[model samples]
Target: MIRKANLQLLIDREYGIGKHGAKAEFARRLGKQADYISRCLYPAEKKGGKNVGEDFAREIEREFSLPVYAMDQQRLGSDTAKTIDVEGLPAPLAQKIAGYRQVVEVPRYDVAGSMGPGTEPPEMNMVVENMSLDANWVRNNLTYTKIDNLKLISGRGDSMAPTIRSGDAVLVDSGINTVEDDAIYFFLMRGKLQIKRIQRGLDGLTIISDNGQYPPIEVPGEREEDITVLAQIIYWWTGRSF
Candidate 1:
């Protein structure tokens, strides 16, 4: 998720300045729009590299009559992995998903039953050749160390590539709250899973992809199926080639 823009919004929210206030008004007077400030908060897509660096800060300070602080470690990156604790979530639901890291397993086996007597035993011709059981499920499949409802699942498509690649493992936390914006979430529709940023719309929600190749997906309109949020992706683990 875009933390910088969100932070600026939070600042606006706290100060009752809304999006169009002195800060924004002064920035606009200096020819810097809200998007400029928003981009300053997080410089993912801006030109001239990320965050505009020192030069942008100087410009903002000189023209906008604002203070531009150096980019600290805390200022960078998404807030997803930083903190995740939701209020008002149902206790039962939270408990149900808590520590459910064990992978459910179903076992397969073949069974043979035969009756032998003095008389010629009836041919045990394939009486029952198959049986299935979930064996060693808790012991072998899943992890139980972390007491979090978050679990990792492999991503499938290139829609969220670079940010979240195919075959990459993404951590999903159902305990997190769904915010309206660019947020990685495990959204379920008709029992299928989709990882996309949540965009607020006039009617409902919009699912956005980072790659830009795939168009944004709108829920309820494009697909009439029910949209259930399985979890929100907090962090993803990817590998670097040596």
Candidate 2:
């Protein structure tokens, strides 16, 4: 996932003009023969691919004239590239690594007639689109339950250590903004998703970290542009043997 993100950014930085370059490059990378790359961005087309899927990587290499590769998720920081020849990658691998599509059972509510006491909990099938990473769920899906499609993303940095040790997975809630006093959350600041706690101050929102070694991230009125509440962390799962 990280490799795919880095790949996207790398491509964007190369051909995207005023941030529009990524879209253009994505179209080119996908082999769009027409000039639809410059079209409006509201077409609801799910474009691009992520790691564990090498086909898209090969396409990017061919389109951008760059060496595109996917690294192992477990040892993401290393130089290991499980190379697959551009012509040998199977199409099913792309579909599988792209995430699996599942139907979520939603209750069908009656709106046309009077309310009844013995209401049947009709199972309405709702398609949950497969996302690149489970983290993408926070942005793509709408929440219905407190634990709706929530996922535990392994901590990357040392800012939230001990309570959430580096490489430990932290359970995050995508439903409600239950910003408690010291709970950790997946925050979005400057187009990046980070883990931090919300500390309310007299003047602004201060992003507090568990390890006091680092100072609190204060978002004063002047610095309001710095902090944005993407989602709050309801639970933290730590110390898994695997």
Candidate 3:
């Protein structure tokens, strides 16, 4: 039998039960009842109820981007002792599963760029630090192919309130320097780095703030190069607030 501790570790590491209502969020993603998932994580000792079964284990492997064999070992125990080859699976799926086993380090800049009203953007000195993120999370969340080009920077200002709050850390894909319609981007405007939603117009590009308090800014289509696009904001997380 698979030890309960191993299963609990997987839940705590991946689902993060107490953090951000992760248990409920994971349940919703897995399309399973929350109570049932809770039971699977903490099975009853007296009644000897069924633990997480192979069906649910496979579902978790597929949905959560985990190795099926690892979960199988923890759920089915000796039955899954023999090494299973992943070569039989489709090439793309196999490659993704293989990538999940690795970790990637992303560079985090020292400066915090404004998202709302602010002065000129500060210069990016050397990278202040590096953060190790799961390769699976990076590949699944970001559309960019070159993972090395990804950078992390902090956003300052309430102009983008409600959606992206002040002091939030955003992941910027430096490879995507082009402005896509209605897409949020981190760019340099008048030497100041700012993040805003861009909308292409007949005459120019419209820069918008999520907060209604701030009015939009317009740039002539011919002078688009003046506004140097640094990167497109892919993902962001609350900094100190969390």
Candidate 4:
């Protein structure tokens, strides 16, 4: 028996069932009726009272290159349902699945990078603490491929307000130090680390803040070295402030 949620996730990921006409296409590829396949996949549903047989389950595993046994082992009320253990799976699949279950620790510094009116930046000290994020979430959301190069920094000031409030924790990819048009970046200017949206033009680069109160600053394109792009902002976490 397979848990309906896990079965659905596997089918959606492996067979592209969420797309239009994919269910029919999947059934066609398996040489089975779509209705029968649906019933087997959703045995608890009123219209789907049939459980998937071992032969059909093996057939699905062979045809789709899926870990059917691993999914079936996730059935509710099973002895091993307490934890998600992929030890029984093949090496490659086990490794891939295990990666999702793993967590990545990103270093969080105490220093706050000004986002509004500029201020003298503090020397970033040793990592104050580590923030743990899901490996899969980090891989999916970040532009950079390397996980170790990620760092967490706090935002200061109200220049980037509304979008990035003060005290927000931002995930920065230090590996990405180039200016991407209209994208937010953390960089050093006049010895101070700042977060701003950088837009490139033929004349120069325009550094902007979301709050209209702050005027944009222009820097010559040829003098790119004047500002050392520390990292690119990937994700942000903030709480409501009164």
Candidate 5:
């Protein structure tokens, strides 16, 4: 689902404070009317206020020259090591995209997928920075189930300290939304965000914290629906010069 918050973030980045006629400028940039922009961002309680649809997201990417489905991604670039079909593009364009199979630009968003004792997660997939890595390197280094689903985000809290210190970053496979293995998972529980090791048992799942100070949170098979597994924590770092 394309979150309306993401679109609002894009507009804010392009036209924040000091940008005179921000709304109109943003609308013009998207080839939309100022009134339409207002309608999209208008409060839900307001009449004629509608959430922006998938089509609008496509238009945004097309207008900004972003990759296809860029707006829909919660994270970016991973080496699927699979072939990328560039069959329908113009000769030169196809050749350019074909080269992309070797390397890809990965996004790092400003939001954090809280490690424990949570905080609210960003509703939008806003890209603040991007890093490029070889497809082979990603495929070899990161354990992932889906290609083009890994995006980097910061981590907070010490519930998973040592394993994932505060201010650290993690590359999450946003595509994997299940307890495939007894590994670390980035998930949502009771409307809050958490990143912890989840042990899957016949009964259900166990949310664990590496720090002995914090106790485990259990999700019995009956209450498994209470937690939403957003992704699996594939790789992590201290966000330093290491």
Candidate 6:
């Protein structure tokens, strides 16, 4: 059977906004409606999500010129992108290792975010030194569709304590603007950029600080106008003395 996660990752890597992948173009190429394609990709029960039938799956393979039954395989996206040795690793893990040769520069920017690797101008010199990351690894290991949708923002204070210390830089996924689930997020609050772990509960939402010294703040429902979820922190990096 064709795995839904496999197909979704394929779409993300091959047809997401990053890496020159556009859903509208993909839809046009398949001779299908963009909305229909989105429903197939996103597949939410509350929304108009649907599964791709066997016939449609075969059609997709044919359209993409993939081998017969390729979609039925795990990590279908990983196998097709510039073949390389996986060293017998699992499909999910193998894909990440296969792209060590493919690296991209991820520049540092404000939490508000005005730049990324793909859009860096040579004269600007905004790109951070030694900030290059494996392209395919970023696409596979990180968020599926966030190949170029990242920017480095410096974390401040010890609100997140042992998890994210003061002055450490976090790789923020600029593509996510909503709180789809509970996770650490870099956001704007009352006109200032802030990072915190956000959780949704039955009564309301709680903005938490990993450091217990700082108390959590509760926001009833969502304050879209005052608070903006600028991006989600996918990865972080720091170097220090012993």
TM-score of 5: 0.58
Q: Judge candidate 5 against the unseen true structure and give its global Cα lDDT, from 0 to 1.
A: 0.75
The TM-scores of all predictions, comma-separated, are 0.37, 0.37, 0.62, 0.58, 0.58, 0.50
Give per-residue lDDT, candidate 3, residue 181.
Answer: 56
lDDT of 5 at 54: 79
Query: What C-alpha RMSD separates each model from the true structure?
Result: 20.5, 18.3, 8.4, 11.0, 15.0, 17.8
In model 1, the runs with Cα more than 4 Å from the true position are 1-147, 177-181, 220-225
Best by TM-score: 3
Look at candidate 1 and tell me the lDDT of residue 207. 71
- Whole-model lDDT values for every prediction: 0.48, 0.47, 0.72, 0.73, 0.75, 0.67
Q: Model 2: what TM-score?
A: 0.37
Off by over 4 Å in 6: 1-101, 110-130, 222-224
TM-score of 6: 0.50
Q: Which candidate has the top score in lDDT?
A: 5
In Å, residue 48's CA in model 2 sits off its true spot by 45
lDDT pick, better of 1 and 6? 6
**Which of candidates 3 and 5 reaches a greater TM-score?**
3
Which parts of model 5 are misplaced by more than 4 Å? 1-100, 239-242
Q: How many residue pairs clash in each candidate?
A: 1, 2, 1, 0, 0, 0
* Winner by lDDT between candidate 4 and candidate 3: 4
